[model samples]
Target: MRYEEELIDEVREKNDIVDVISSYVSLKKRGSNYVGLCPFHNEKTPSFSVSRDKQMYYCFGCGQGGNVYTFLMEYNRLSFVEALQELAKRAGVELPEREQTAEEKQQADARLTLRDMNKEAAVYFHYLLKSKRGTQALVYLKDRGLSDEMINQFGLGYADIYRDDLYQYLKAKGFSDYQMKESSLVNIDTVKGNYDKFFNRVIFPIMDINQRVIGFGGRVMGEGEPKYLNSRETILFDKGRNLYGLNYAKRSRSKSLILCEGYMDVISLHQAGFTNAVAPLGTAFTPNQAMLLKRYTNEVILSFDSDGAGVKAALRALPILRENGLRGRVLSMKPYKDPDELIKAEGQEGYQKRIEEAESGRMFELLVLYGQYNQQDPESRTEFIHEIAKKLAQIEEPLERQTYLASAANRFMIRKNDLENLVNRYGLGYQYEKVNEQYKTPPETEERRQEKKKSNKNQPQRLLLTWLVEHPEMYQYIRAYIGADDFIEPLYHSVAIMLFEQLDNEEKINPAAILSRFTDAEEQKEIAAIFNTHLKYGLSSEDEDKALSDVVRKVKLASIEDEMVHTSDIVRWQELLSLKNKMQKFSISRS
Candidate 1:
């Protein structure tokens, strides 16, 4: 309704849901619907079902369902406006410019202003990188094997030795102290006032997937307390949620990403023609980062430092990758400490060969565990063999697990049958543990969004609304006894009112458009479930009438009971008692 309803319909009509989702997920035709693995969660089985007829998708496993716009917004982590713009462009439907309200305009302007400040700051820093003040920084970068082209490509720059350089520059450009502080480019020190956060460092402007400069990473030019510093979490950026060089790396035609440890690693890899490389912004890998990566690529190649800490980092990252259904591999940069050193010694062809030869994540883990134990020692070797079996048990697929079982036995020169017995023993325990975990209660946040409150009253309200959606022609018959107000649950009542209004006006109900009415992602999903709940198929006409009659009575009786609890008027109370009696005989027919 914000834009004309027709405009949204036009956009939706132009871009078919199946066509749009197919680009992201590999869906197979199954009856009238397509099914695939749910991208929102890590599931081996395909439970994500898309309906071509309804122009909607629902994941039976995760229960995340919605129309095409919601699919794009959820999968790409885009805002509704951003999703609209993206779909509009793809559909070739030029959206008419719509005016923003005062409050909305203010918020939009603030975000725009911050991005503008960051852009201006990038230009200024890039200018200074070429200026005399950046001589030392530029020399250091060049010495590190970074070309001038790479420097320009990454928008690499320098923060002058002056503490207030960027602060002064931003202030001169008419940015307020509040804006400067909010941008995270300047720190507020009561003693020093506003000062640049990245002084005496080489700067790397961190861009989002949209190529907007939201934050910055600055490595100290010389020895300092912290060698590298990143902009703190701000309205514009969260380090855990964004990856460095992702703006360019995401465009790589490859289905995988080369994940590195630092900005230089990503830059060097990009410069060496591995433009798919990206790195966390001076933080350990996070689940949010994993989900973000999942949106872009199915696999990630871990290119970490070859030092002990690097090995530890890789160990830490593998499980998170597995949890998100990402196929992780370790880059075998053995002779070199990191990707930079490897690339410097061997170049792109060697790196490409290494990438092709990257080990599977489980194998990498086994190798790391192998390094910890001395195979020459009898006790250490026995423990290492047990560890391999335990890890192999964790692999849920029998074909994959059995293949690893043989590989581990041959690779370690252990008896295949002996190892197989230990794996089977561990696999049983793992299976038991997994089954137990499934029965444990979900977190409260998930409960709130997925299933708000399930009760006897809730079920009837939910079913009645769903009934109206699937059989709108039945609304006229059902309206004689129960109305939208009788569907007491707030969300259900709101939806019922809309359904009735649309029906009264003689317009076909658009469930997807109704979903557009709720902007909050959680509410949209909850609303989607009202229509998405599977109705019993192949019902006898008599059975259908009985089901509808029963649902209507239940909803009406519950609504009356709820009203009786709150009513203060004696006359209204008397009417409610009489209405309660009238409700007991309430029944409707298909005719």
Candidate 2:
């Protein structure tokens, strides 16, 4: 649910972004905006820029950018509503209660129905675990070192061997087969008739961060092909988007999350008092999962299995973690397959010791890559070094890159300068092409090239919108020829609609308030980048005029070409061609 735009804007107006951000981050004014080391990622230099003029913040290093609500959501792991409530309270403003729209209300009702069904199903499963029919299943859990209290805490249960047991129970409780199927608790087949989804398996209820049961996972008590079966995607569940024990892990005071490989591993860790442990839903770690982790903590330690598959999974997860602005570490559970095995061999203290000595995300990747090649052989070692250089090049911040590069050089007995050169060579080749395309002049210095790497038809639109944001006075002349429809780029087009509306009404253009209109983080980030786009300045007025003209012409040409592609009518094509040629001669008016 979203608050009304007027109410959101009022709250935002009271809580200045710079003032609010200053309480959390030590920001010092540099030029027109505030500059500080980005709190989202580790950096020696201050790459995070906060603009009071626009009321937005962006990490030039990590690409995390947004308005005030976004800042709270990312920095403190609060949801949009949560952030809104906090800001409203802090500013001593009252948020007005509002009713949901017809569509929103209907959607809400459906979600509520699903939640109620999942909750009822969870209760039934938990009750069965303590019943006479669940004796063998209970015995299996007990043998696996699960106490009655732990079982109760996790809402663990068992499905009887009878296929129709749960189906009948749910049906008697007034939940239709359609609802049951939607909840993924029961399946109705024409040939096999209706039956339970899980039979003769230990059930683990997968709850959301609110501790509401959204889905379930069942591990087979005896021999089975899958061995572990998780609830399929339903209205209430998306395995890729949700983690198994986040409800508990989010509350852990620890600053890091311990990511395990499976349900048993997560439960075992929780039982052993590592309350911050979580796991993916029976799949490889995903970018979404890492971003989810980013909300709770900046660090996530990978506690995957130590076998070949586990090593591969860890390697796969590390880059995703780094990309999502997390400081990922990898722990070794050697001589033991998993955390559960390790807890049995050595106690909680030993596990803590292993965690303390976990390898840094970079070191782990480097060491794994190093192990893959014969270090003593020159050709293999050179290949290994190049791989190392490529990985180093991916780190956008030079200081951080140099720090890791020097460490890699020292570890491998290579010269720091040589490794640094290899990294820069790889980094610059790609950066030059991308940055060169965005700007007319070749990036003469590192700072110029590091502004941004965007290249596409959208770049001009992004550039023009950014220009309007920084210099809205130009809209008096710019609007005569260009309009929202001319943006062509979908996101830019949407922003331009609002921007042009505000400009037309002669309202003060507040980029921050405009940013608050977007709800999704990715949308807000792109919107922020639009407001904060780095427009390279030319040396003279003539140069600046020429650059602006080029951007306007590019934007107009792209829109014309786009219209011609969709229109089959010869008249429309001819009109588009005439406009394209006219736009080529379009000049800025001073009036």
* Candidate 1 vs. true structure, TM-score: 0.78
How do the residues 1-591 of candidate 2 rate in per-residue lDDT, one tens digit apiece?
Answer: 457788888888888999988766657777899976577766545678998878889986667999889998876555567688899999999877766667657666777888888888788888888999888889988998987778989999888899999889888888887777777888888888998989888889999888999888998988996898999987568777689999999999998999999888888999999999999998777666776787788899999999999999998888777755689899989989999989999999989999999999888999999999998899999999999998888787878888899899999888999998899899987577545643444335666555444445368999898888877887887777889999886778889999999899988888887788777788888888777778886546666667788888899888888889999999989988988889999877452
**Residue 125 lDDT in model 2?**
82
| Candidate achieving the largest TM-score | 1
- Per-residue lDDT tens digits for candidate 1, residues 151-247, read 9989999999998989988989999988888889998778867778899999999999999999998989878968998899876787877899889
lDDT of predicted model 2: 0.84
Q: After superposition, how far is residue 34 of candidate 1 from its true place, in Å?
A: 9.0
* Candidate with best lDDT: 1
Q: lDDT of model 2 at residue 44?
A: 45
